[model samples]
Target: MTTENVDTLEFNPISAASRNGGYVALGTLGGKCVVLSNLSKNVVKLSPSDMKEMDLKTVCGADWCDDNYTYFHPKQEVMVFDLRRLATDIIRECQVKGVYVESYERKSGVWLMPDGGLAVNSRKLWRPDGTVLEHGIHAERIYSASGDIGFDLDTPAANDDEVQCVLNAFGGINWRNNLGAEMLLGWFGVAIASVAMRRRPHMLLTGAAGVGKSTALEMMKWLSGKLAYASTGPQTMAAFYQALAGTSRAVILDEFEADPSRRHSRDTLEIARMSYSLQEGDEGIVRGTPGGTARSYTFYSPFLAACINPAKFEPADVTRWVVLEAISRKPDAVALKEAEARVIGPRLARRFINRWANFQKNEAIVRKHIIDAGGDGRMADTVGVLLASYWTFVSALPATDSEAAKLVELLDIQDRIALHAITDEQRCLEAMMSKVLPFKFMDGIALVTRNLSIAEAIQRICDDPTGNLEITMRLAQLGMRVGCVQGTWRMFVANSPEHQELRKVFGGTKWASGGWSTVLRRLPGGTEGTQRIGAGFGAAKVTIFNMPADLLPANDGSALLAA
Candidate 1:
């Protein structure tokens, strides 16, 4: 059935063998029989009808083959079972004799090329000494969207001046302070060393339009070279997972506003939350596929976002981001040049890659220093990697002892600010207090209408010994009660109308739930207490937050009301 009909058959096994260079095998993937061969780079999944046609070229040249092989075949129908058996026998023979040559597969990130050079992406490879090569090398086998943007670095020497472009571009953002600018610089370090680090932190560059958000994104593209997937708008979680699959390329999403109310935005936030730390044996974000099977997506890359309107996230999600707010360009600020970013981005990336071994060494030291300076585990990780990365970049630069001390002092200040930063609970408390509600006085019955501030009404009632029962009753209907407890004034919060209203602004946060007692207790100067503000309500249990000095009884209880 084989050689006897080889002359008349549409597909000849002998001819197919010769065309394939005698390199092919049968392998199973996802419980489906597939043909693996050196003629293609991926597994070839053929249909039963195609097998009936005995299409040797289509079957062998499927994505499974690494190279193209010519095989001519007629359209005549063939016995599918016999052909399958013959193909199986050929694969078995090839396997036994070791005829197939498998291509070496490499992960998509900074990797060493076969020629002892470093491959940063599809279009660029650097020599051992951080110099760009004349021709590109196929250093990676994984498919990536970032591979389309080729790296065009030609820096003969990747020196401090070459990397200074990063500092200069970041400087253009008009950061609120030196810490924010320095943190952005450190983020560049995180992007370069993303593949090597176990925990890659994320960044959010948020501000008003014309505040250099897009420019910052462009700078990220330049610094990342071929190791970044830069998007101009918001994207779904699936898009991010697909783009970052099997690669450590930094994800830069410009104009990425994550509204927690929307399902898609929530999913995006969830992705960022989960990507912060990669614990050992951590099974990545598991999602249901079209076939009802679970697919795991592991993102090793750092996520960066730029937006005008920042989205509110849960405490867990907020801690994962090193939020850097951008400001209007100062009148005296230096303008960043695109030409410099284009050239210097690749140079900075090369420096980071070439000095990776040393960066790791310095990062450990910096992490220890951060932890010693009152930073928690997460803070240490986020700020430590950044400082460590910056130090790694400028360590080669000649500096005085004072200059080195300045860097240490900067790290100490950043650590202190991070440690004392406004927490999510505190933000929620402030938001709730700032929320304005109306209270109109009518005899003893307070109408919940207008011309009153919530803080003012609370202060007025607490200061008046005559007992403003109307305002107290109004407060009760809104799920809250405010009065003076001893010398300190406190506001009692419960599950009511105010709770639901606050939930709208603070959704996806701890304050969104009915468990206000536990959350409010975390606020500064807060405790559990009972307040009986109205009749028939016998000392209702409530979470109490003490009014701060500013809100405490002013000289006539009119301080808050004046504004």
Candidate 2:
């Protein structure tokens, strides 16, 4: 606070015209109230306290500044020695500010300090008191007890009725289908994610159409303000990057378009990958004229996606989300969750956000314990974050409440279940079985049969599924090679003998697009570098395309040869 006022401080100009083009106020750097300026563009490294200093003069020194604060002139009009001090000062300042961090990527936004306190919003980014920069643009922000949001959300004062509403919403969510604890933890993560800038778990609430899946998401949106976009979210890669360039808020996808067998496009999958990359670096994109470059800053934030079926996303991408299920949803009562959201929601959110580091640390402990106790590696990261959020909520609960212990017990059970789910290969097996080998009893073993070609398989699936037929076909083809294959691969795309035998079925231009022998080449005998397509071919050539067949279940979820 030892800043000089503009009216009191005098600036001696070389002449009248150079009175003051402008003066930048520089503050304490490396714990000293010293100032340095040289057109350094790393503005995010500036601290919030430093950003408020008023007009200070910059002395361009060719050699060095005297201890007596004397300004010297250069012999020639060239870049000054002052450049070295400016660079050095910036490096020192960044070290003190933790900006050169390896663990935390951004120099701004919400940061969790090691002491378990939160450095939030402008405190982390060096913005003005009441503004937020999102998507490479600054936007007005209004903060409540719930912390910072991009827009205004009217939440009433904490009241008994609202508290009861929170408890009721917590109690009434259908947890019968083994989803009670995970759902509650997801709610806490959304609340905490409001002030968390790191890569956190995405929440995917799944249930039937009439269920209250969206109700919980709506409540989080109300808490999130303009920061939360409540549509199906960006389906294309460009749109997604545009919608979330610099936002650190909750982006909720209320009714995502999901297809279980669908594989994400390369660019689309990049979005999912970047969503949880949790590293420090720029995801570069070359834009502007040929000679110009602008940094399109990318970041990972919390996202919530809801739909009827949640099994569509690939195994890798699915691990990024904490899935919650609502079996019995009353559409009429959704507004009640919204109303209650306005009351105790912000208070509860503030509780976890203020101590985000504690929750994060606790999450690590829970994750290790779960994995050691035999949790799924796929579910390891997801369960850890969810359990940490749940424990944070429990700690925030009033000790006087009689039901607190019960809630704690339920949370413990939920934690155990999530951990145990990794070992429950039977469920993954059953779900996988439902796909390739639908539920059918044969003798005492379960198996599936088919003789469809690549075109026929694509037709059966794509004839009604959402995404473009071309992309769907392409993904299915990729899956046929990778998902269906076991061990190493050796087969080339297609061969002369295979095409000659399958000429009648895949002869014409329609089925002979990019990969005509996909079905015939992917059969069990595919990896031997050569495959026979049809039953006959005039002793040398045939007229049938690749054929699908019945199979036995291999323990690893791949199809086994039963021929």
Candidate 3:
């Protein structure tokens, strides 16, 4: 390679083979490999031609099949080379230095790394045509060759008694209104049993303080076989991954705190996102041969679950996870007292262990529903399953109006919060209206007006009369004579009953010419003669001549002025 191009080439040493006085293998810039060695302290590069003269017995190590190794060095970047093609002329001439290699087997048209050794980097498992097969970090190992590697899952006999036991352990006392807890149980119980359609069915349980989230998780643990529990925090990624390695179908991540350093809550949401898919890794092995001792690693299972407080989670998190909110309220004090007196935790656990099979069957049904719904079904169904499963736990709790309303609001707000499409003031007003308004107000109108439209008008009315009176006095100011006269209130616009009715409604009066004279008398400018002339009155009771209907065209003249 040219000197300029050499800068881009990466080299890795195959540690296991090289440590045994073997030729150090190297991966080329273009993902090819070569071997290098030191002969009498003079660094000697070994090409494919050199390999023919060298005895296989004399050589400490040789790049067998590139498929057998993957390279990952802490200092240099990682790459994979196909040793099966090592005899090719292109690979024969390449200088392999600072390059590492790992073995892989082509099985079912897919390349798989051997047992006891995992692919150092998951991205290397791609098709010969360069299509990436795996995209994320391999957090779990799947061992196909090791018959001894197995998962321990509890298999309770399938029967109604067992089912009831599991249901009772999951807090399934009754079915009505225990939606959240029931759904939680279905998800967790089925998930622990490894019955989820997807390899990973992450459960997220959130609720207010003093609610039984942690306690419920503890109960689940007692119901299942040995489970690994990890308490996640802002810096728990390493710990979380490490803990995930030890378990098969179940992992309880408790007290997960959303890192505040992020712009949003749930700093490790990215990790949570990846857990939806399965990952592969290698397991280490120890073998002794006449040549020397060898160590290898392989891949194994993927299944995990997590629980977090709602305050520490973002709305977007609720979408990816099966979310269950726990409410702390005792529906029936007497029943709760009796259950508490009975020490039901152990009874519940016993029931769960008994009905584990039915839980698995029901989980299968739920998984089919999820698949039928086409990848992450609507949030309601996802949450509904959990509520249905844990129904008995919260059934005895009396429902509070505030709690019910909060649940409804939470459901509605999720769409907005998840999408970030609502204004802060609108959210505030919703809270206020929900608390203060007796009658249901139009949410659309409230959103459009921002609660300020009517609120501002009302405030002004209570603040100043002159400014406020304009709202009530606009019609009278529009040249409509409106007031009381004699014993009745009247409003006259061309001396019509329509005007009179309007007058009654508005509490006003109107007359032909006499009323106009009475109003003018109260005005700044008025003369006795002018008043009498304007009034046209000649009797004890004020009277005025009614103008002919068409004396002045209705369109052009005021009937009072014409009279």
Candidate 4:
């Protein structure tokens, strides 16, 4: 064709062409014919026929010949020539920078390569329009075909070695703030993990001040390589989502405080929830964007653990967490000193890695067991894949049934705490009540008298309680009517004739305040000066009345029952 005519020809290129339908034209350039293809509205020149002929000889490569063509040049690049021009142009151009072209055949769409001759036996090429031309048995194809042919190859063999490795890496023991108690309580965590794998499992750990929750989390970090710690509250859900999308493992959230000053916005939480279920590239702006953005964001690594102090959060936050109540007993000085002196962190990490490797070897069995225990079956594979690297740490440690039991217990406690924090007002009230009355009295009250529900009572206590008297008033409003009778304010059953029964159960006279004083009176030498009073005394004599029997149990049976 003449140059003017060639220039006049439209180069409107479709995204891709099919092998059976698309066309490419060759025009004379100098004395040689130059291959060209339409790219949307523009025409781009390809290699000259003479150059293609010369390069075909020197460019040693492997070519796969089938319905579709794939060419791989040794020490060069790879290219796929499909019958469809759209697919051919896009795939070729996109991968061209990374591959070297060698010999190609136009008619058969065959390519020759230096690496593996006739590699096309199991390859597939896709056109720009998303049509696939199967050349060889692809991994996905094999999986599909096997199912179609009733091969029944879906059963996964257990990797006992891998499971053992992971168990070892974790030191067979899972540590937490309340090591003894949490060991018994951590089963809820297992359940949660199982659930998360199926749906989206996210956990938040919170506990009282001075608890070693942070320390425990740090230990987990050493075990799980896919952990990331967050130190501040300004981090947006979007940022965290993006971070998680890149990793295939779990994340470790550390020092997360539910401080009102640092609380995440509602939008942030929504995004976070969305992120848990979103795969990479499946995430996009569902709203807010003008035309809506299609995000192909990558998947974030799952969070392995999260740790926070209970004091840092409000009661409203309990629902979102699996709390591990820290041990009230302070760590012994000698234990603290030893921990401080030794470089246990790195050792722990190494142990975890070794255990993970062992676990990976037995993954199938372990996963099956986990699934049987209510874990997500789909994530059975991931459990092994993700934990395989940290198994050594657990294997060498002293792991016992007791420890496992303890872990399950702790997990249960956390679940309870989370549920109470989220939905149950009585639990919140119990927590608040503990601060005012003895912890033992948390569930002792027959009725709570307060203007508001348990939630309101707790909130009021948290917000403004001038003194014990105000607390008494708030409690009275709920139901456990506390009033000044005989000049002493005391809790009493509202309009109940079972005053004697209440006294016997709670250990105090009808008018006496049944609390610390009554408890103290039962102690040795505590009730020496205490005086007993007859029933029906007015509010005046109630203060002087001391009925230790009201506080004392009738027998060990009653005490045990009360306990």
Candidate 5:
């Protein structure tokens, strides 16, 4: 009942006071029943009701330190200190020698390995416990299976025939390099890049059902072990936020296709769009409850998917994946069997990991080289790691490796691909915008105006010619929101929820939108605003873009799909 009997009580008064350099006693000092003091800190005397609000009994340090936060476990368990938020004391009592309170807190949602690194599974991370899981989902760290062997190319050296056989099943060495690079990313993607460079490209194996798409993914599954997952993968943005609360390397969304039966596939496509830029600072907010656990979850993970036609994938999402179409369209039964039999799965996986790790070791040098060779600045690390992965498998003999020499060549191809894609997209956008700018809208219904009197939106470019690309780039920057207001598309820059302008434009509007940055798009009949439209000219799905207006389909303007 009194501070004098603190030793007899479970709470250690001396330790608590020492931690914050303050005295917390149940004796009146300011005409109050309790006195709490810290060195030149806030002095608040809590009455009985106020004590409950402060959760006083749980206070270990000062009156209110880290009282509200619940830390994560490496295995995705949500937990808190035994004495409310007094993590230090509980960790001290845990008697797990050498483990700090922060270590157990899993603040990073990643395992800070005792070996001095991090472990992530299923894009999920946790506090390190000297072990990591060997399988994805529900499979926590495989005890004693130190990431020592699993994430490295520790396999016995295979002969050319053995390696070539595996290569053949994966569409030969050409496909192998690209696929192998992407597959290894499934394990280390989230960990290797900084926030700016953290986008981990996904993988798509497209082929007829029996063409062995599953077999290719199975090969990846073998290499990845616990990091390869086959679940639906954060089915909704809310679920995506929840998923971010954990760790993972790669996720598999199999048989990926837009559900033809549905009116729209917003959930599916939004999830796909998200896969491209699921890093810490991306725009999507999780949990409807603002400023809650959603604040703690940041999304980043690689995806490996198989589908007949990734009909639902957007061009933006398409670029985020390394597409590998099955060469044997009629179902390569032989190749399927070979891939599943672990012919080169184990060795190839090892080599990829080891080489990728080596690239990371030489990250500075490799990154410089890629940039010098004109690799896309945004994906420099990606190209460097991919080239390193290719060279590692091409030959152990560095001198004989044309693969290493091809780093420049590969990067050249990448630059060309990027340039070509951008050029094509710009042409398409110009055509669409040409049609769009002259259109007249009343009550949000869009119709082409007979006269070209309304200033062409192209004037936006003439004002700041550079601004056109800036606007275009911003549109494609991972999570830009182009909402459909009635049948008209508006770049929903919900210019800050605090702005009266935003409230005026978006207030009570039932718009189906993604991220607070977007205005929620409201469809007729109270439907959410996601739709599936086929993208042509090799685009896996339709995308918002910038280009020459002359190239846009004469009849198509801004709709969810071009078709």
Candidate 6:
């Protein structure tokens, strides 16, 4: 290399500090002499061959002196041997400090470039006062394989209406309602904030075959710009995890399904489950490596999935997803252009880079708005980030009254969905109530009725003793009993072979192992302690769940109840 070229290479201050302190004799990584280069604007590792090929004196830059040439470079191979020996001796004891990163990263609210510049966005270098830096200092040193990689900003320069243009184009999709479009916008905001936010929500687009789900996903990919990894159907769990392993970039998948019956589907769902919360310390999903050790991965990436049939997840997993349904396109509806998104995306990214601090400040206001409107804490985490981020961008501009009102409508719609969501326990109870518990009566003749719940059958037997004689006798044979406990009705379900069918109703529930009492106690007016109640079935003191006398109205015990 030429002297002029070598003059531009930046000396490593961290290595100098470490050498002076004697923490490490040489700040070498992977058997190479590592230094910061201002020309490349990256931490460059140079091997002995590389040093030998370059103009040694010039490449040494400010670190060079006459003594350094006599002791270290008199014989090039000897210096290599010496460095290799030193590496062997102190490698385990010393904590080497240097910029070993190979990709773009965000640290402490500042974006770090591979070229050693501090960027405000993918395109512009950062300045403290919200202006672009022309020739900023190449001084920030970050050590991470955790990539928040950036791409070239190919959009037009920021204009006054950039954010509005992005939103208006998004609203052009064939979404079922205004709420769906608004929520999609909110999710886009969440994706923009993925690197910094702790609790990120996922998005799912659903509709019939021709509803433009793929088009919507394509728009998101452009808007995500450099921060998104797009995948199609038939994805493997390993590939999916590898794509998101160390990055916080959003994953946008079209025709994605997570059916548990398939091994890969289950694995994909499991990765999604693990990505939801940022747990304490290094808690994460562990996979065994070929080296016989384990690598723990915690992904903070948000996922956007598009599918025709919705994937069924356990209730907890369901809460993590924000599903947007598409509608049949009107004949004149303008199709979303991937080309337009490519430009608008970078523009939105620039806006996010500038407004991130303000977005953090508005979080409290957004959270209160959601909770006060009857949304729960989960909704606060899942929906609040979306609303806050979108609000931050719009409020930065001169927002119209209609823009502000639409936000309120979004919250109102989310609140209603949250309030009406059925709990897992409620689903199990509903299934149980619809079940017909058969028994033999009248000298081995089987008795069955589709017009009553287990509770109502007992209620009928208690209310009309003589008329329900056959029913009462049949229930006694099955060891089922019912009676009033402190003025509230309770049913004692005996642990008998005849009652085994009831346990199937609790499948995929917290009470799946037949531990129905634990979950049933969480129901309204239900008690943790089982009641010992006598019944028309013969006064047997069996332990069972307590239910309010009128908790479940009579139902034809045929099919499972709708949630």
Off by over 4 Å in 2: 1-108, 113-117, 123-167, 175-177, 181-199, 232-236, 259-270, 282-291, 309-311, 330-340, 396-563
Two-way TM-score contest, 4 vs 6, winner: 6
Task: In angstroms, give how far residue 215 of model 2 lies from its true place.
Answer: 1.7
Error of 5 at 393 (Å): 4.0
User: Relative to the true structure, how large is the alpha-carbon lDDT of every model?
Assistant: 0.59, 0.42, 0.34, 0.32, 0.40, 0.55
Q: Put down candidate 4 lDDT per residue, 366-472, tens digits, no spaces.
A: 44444444544433333322222222223443334443334334333343333343322233223323333321112234443334433333333332322234444
Task: Tell me the tens digit of each residue's lDDT in model 5 across 1-563.
Answer: 11233221122233432234322332332223332233322223443344441344433333334333334565767654343333333233322222111101122223324353445322222222323343221221221112332332224434556555555555522342344433333323332221223345555667665656676666556544544445542255455555543343456667666565653345545554565566443444344333132223444556667777565544454455566666553344235353443444445444433343343444445445656655555444444544444444555533223444455554455543563254223332322233321322222343333323112433332333333443333333222233334543333232234534323333333221212332122111222333322112121222232322332223344222421
> What is candidate 2's lDDT per residue for 1-563, written digit by digit as tens?
01123322122112222222221223333333322222221123343344321312233222122221233557765533343444444344334333121222223344443344444443223221223433111221211112344322122233445444554564456644454534454455543453353445666677777667766666667655545556653365656667765555456666564553443333444554565644334543424434342334464556676777554454455566666667775443424455546545665554555445556665666656656555555455665566556655555432222332333344454554543444222232222223331111122253334444443433332223332333233322322211223432222233343343223333332343324433343344533343332222223221122222222122322222211
- Which residues of candidate 5, in runs, are more than 4 Å off? 1-163, 172-199, 207-210, 232-234, 237-244, 259-295, 311-319, 327-357, 361-374, 379-384, 394-428, 434-563
> Cα deviation of 301 in candidate 5 (Å)?
2.0
- TM-score of each predicted structure versus truth: 0.64, 0.50, 0.35, 0.34, 0.46, 0.71
Q: How displaced is residue 503 in candidate 4, in Å?
A: 43
Q: After superposition, how far is residue 128 of candidate 1 from its true place, in Å?
A: 7.6
What is the C-alpha lDDT profile of model 6 across 1-563, one tens digit per residue? 01111122223222332112111112354445554332222334555566541333333332332322224456464442233433332332222433233222232223434542335433444442445543212443332212233433333334558666666656666675546665676677677656556677887788889877887788888877778888888677778667776556688888776565667555656777777776323447677766464556566677888998777766676778777778775565554477777767766666665666666666666666666666777777777677767777667743344544456565565544653376676665665565565532333364544445555566565554344666655555544555444544555554432344445544554554665555555666554333323343334324456655464334412111210
Give the lowest summed-lDDT range of ten residues in model 6.
1-10
For TM-score, the strongest prediction is 6
Residue-level lDDT for 472 in candidate 4? 42
Ten residues in sequence with the least summed lDDT for candidate 2? 135-144
Ranking by lDDT: 1, 6, 2, 5, 3, 4
* 45: Cα error in model 6, Å: 13
